[model samples]
Target: MPEFTMSEKIYREEVHFTGRVQGVGFRYATLQVAKEFEVTGEVKNLPDGRVYLCAEGAEREVVAFREELEDRMSPFIRESEIKSDFRPSSYKSFEITR
Candidate 1:
């Protein structure tokens, strides 16, 4: 797969997912799912018991990533809040952050 340039990212958003998302390999699964999309981002566990993710890509790609994430993680995600218009971080690949 080709590396996605920062310049190619036109949509960026941050998501906070609540519920059983912490101990369920959420970050790792997120990284895996990310491998299928041409997006750049990071996923991490938050101290407030939510999973945080920031993804950037073309609008369609980023939105699809979010949809798939929700579909695959439906059982674990109880609530989620998505905030669009996040500042791009120039991430080269998707990752799980400590």
Candidate 2:
């Protein structure tokens, strides 16, 4: 097997996940996932119980993050919407907002 590396392009994205996001470890799970992708940002629960996430990382990682949310984690989430754009930040890791 040959080892290869792909350059990562960083971008910022916001995810809004609705339904059952609270009291189900959604934020914690999101933090774990973010760490896996080496993403840096924050996740929090909105007053209306929606999960809000701000993440910045490689494009591929961001996509994987969203996919994991939609597939392996969709059962925990009723619905989700994602918005992405090019933005740079100096954060090194993700966190669960208070």
Candidate 3:
């Protein structure tokens, strides 16, 4: 039998969403998606009509989070700019940054 091993890399992504992001529950929706996949990080509204996210979790889970945001988030989302990186961090929970 073969044993399963988890990926050693921790995925982190910062998403910059444009168009009708604010005043439309964007942050709230992001929080839900992150929690669904057990991702840990922070999400906040940027001053430049965009949303920022710093997510840290298992590689697969983080990838899922990005997909969900683009595919299943609120209708307010028009376009998204995503930046992904691989690193290590200790994130216990997800949060909505102010």
lDDT of each: 0.88, 0.79, 0.80
lDDT of predicted model 3: 0.80
Residue range with the least summed lDDT across 10 consecutive positions in model 3? 1-10
Q: Candidate 1, which segments miss by more than 4 Å at Cα?
A: 1-9, 86-89
In model 3, the runs with Cα more than 4 Å from the true position are 1-9
| Tens digits of lDDT, candidate 3, 1-94 | 4443446557788778888888888888889888789689988999888888888887788888878887876477788788887766656799
Give the higher-lDDT candidate: 1 or 3: 1
The residue-by-residue lDDT of candidate 1 on 1-98, one tens digit each, is 66666574368889999999988989989999999999998999999889999998887899999999999999999988999863545687888998
Candidate 3: count the clashes: 0
User: Alpha-carbon error at 32 in model 2, in Å?
Assistant: 1.4
TM-score (C-alpha) between model 2 and the true structure: 0.82
Screening candidate 2 with a backbone cut-off below 3 angstroms (N, C-alpha, C), the clashing residue pairs are: none
Q: What clash count goes with each model?
A: 0, 0, 0
Residue-pair clash count for candidate 1: 0
> What are the per-residue Cα lDDT tens digits for candidate 2 across 14-61?
899988779988888888787678678899999987999888887778
Per-model TM-score versus the true fold = 0.86, 0.82, 0.81
Task: lDDT winner between 2 and 3, please give it.
Answer: 3
lDDT of 3 at 7: 62
